[model samples]
Target: MAKQWLNKVLELGEVKGGLAWGRFLFDGNRWVTLMEQAPKGKLVGTDYHGNRYFENEGDIYTRKRFVIYAEKRTNAYNPTSVPPEWHAWLNYINDYEPTTFDYKPPVYALKAEVTATGTPKGAWADPDKRNWLKYSAWAPPSSGARGGKA
Candidate 1:
């Protein structure tokens, strides 16, 4: 019992040091979540996006699954950031590992919020809002304005 508490304390310290000050100090909800999940979970695999997946089966009924976000430690992490295959495993939709299936992610999966202001690049491209086709080239008045012969 003492060892578990010590381990939890150590893990909390590590998490506090590794992440940003805002995440450690302000995001108490995620801190509690990490505290709950860090002790017993076993790391299963890392996805292409750097997200970590963990599972714990302690002879209890249902196995527990957790994920560590690969993005910044801020609260900006979204469910869309998780890939489909990993999402299935995290939600217990499939017992088999995602690697067992030959699945391909769509083009949108590659899109990310490139700007610091939380605006997505490829996903936020709306033709109706900002249409590039509406722009036309500037043409000179005519030959008569320049005193050119007809």
Candidate 2:
């Protein structure tokens, strides 16, 4: 029993060491995001996407920049969520925030695949697959107008 306890204690110490050195991005799956505790940097500004940008000029050798997402669940956060301007700052592309730069988001053409029954369609369906005559919008010629013709 003593040996087992000692092993567990040693494992815990290793985990602590890894966290202190920033080896892992997560911190016990808490509500806080990883970037919130990223390098101790100054809060520069927030981007349009609500991502907070930070920069630390503490020392020439250790200067760093990071971002903490505003998403409630940070674990599912993706780096792509950061806009181009903030992305530039995070990557040190420019010394200043890309305020005046014009950024056009890429447009994507998306189409729905699921059928009315909620089952995913394995193959694409033809738009004109159904017969339209049965559901035609124009009403049949009036019998009186045609002198009671069929």
Candidate 3:
């Protein structure tokens, strides 16, 4: 079991660099948890986005379910990134596996997913309420250029 899990980890951490892919990407706690908790869980299924779901029968309480998101390589996942069906299973909302069921999202839901992913939340869209500096090239003026002492 340990060897199989190690092989999976090696496969997961392998990248085009020919070295461990996620070593530099994930933080310390995340890396450790991935190495430890993973050994106890059985791979339940994988979602369309590549998120891997695991179930640990040994863990009767707390979270028996967990997910290794598709974006683990870049460590860029968030709760918002998971699809609704997968989210439901992860949170124990349902015991059913996501892809096994016949399900289709509403048209509006799909649109929202596409729009939200490439941009910020609509509530934070107003420029006056927040700065877009992080997502934009708009830099503040130099002190001298802005009429401050050089």
- Kindly report which residue stretches of model 3 are placed more than 4 angstroms away from their true locations once superposed: 1-5, 13-26, 72-74, 106-108, 111-150
TM-score of each: 0.55, 0.40, 0.58
Candidate 3 clashing pairs, residues 3+ apart or interchain: none
lDDT per residue for candidate 3 within 1-150, as digits (tens), equals 878887766554343353444443445544654676667778888866667888888876556888776654344555665778878888888788776876577777752141235445333532335543546567887677777555
How far does residue 61 in candidate 2 sit from its true spot (Å)?
5.5
lDDT of each structure? 0.64, 0.51, 0.64
Per-residue lDDT of 1-150 in model 1, one digit per residue for the tens?
Answer: 968775773554344454465565577656664666656767788787777777767624454887776665456556666777888888878876776667666867864332344444433432224433546889978767887666
Selected candidate, larger lDDT, 1 vs 2: 1
Worst 10 residues of 3 by lDDT: 111-120
**RMSD (Å) of each candidate, 1 decimal:** 8.3, 14.9, 9.0
For residues 31-128, write the lDDT of model 2, one tens digit per residue. 12232333335667777666677666763543477666554332434566676667766777766665555555457633322224422333233323
> Candidate 1 regions off by >4 Å?
1-22, 59-63, 99-150
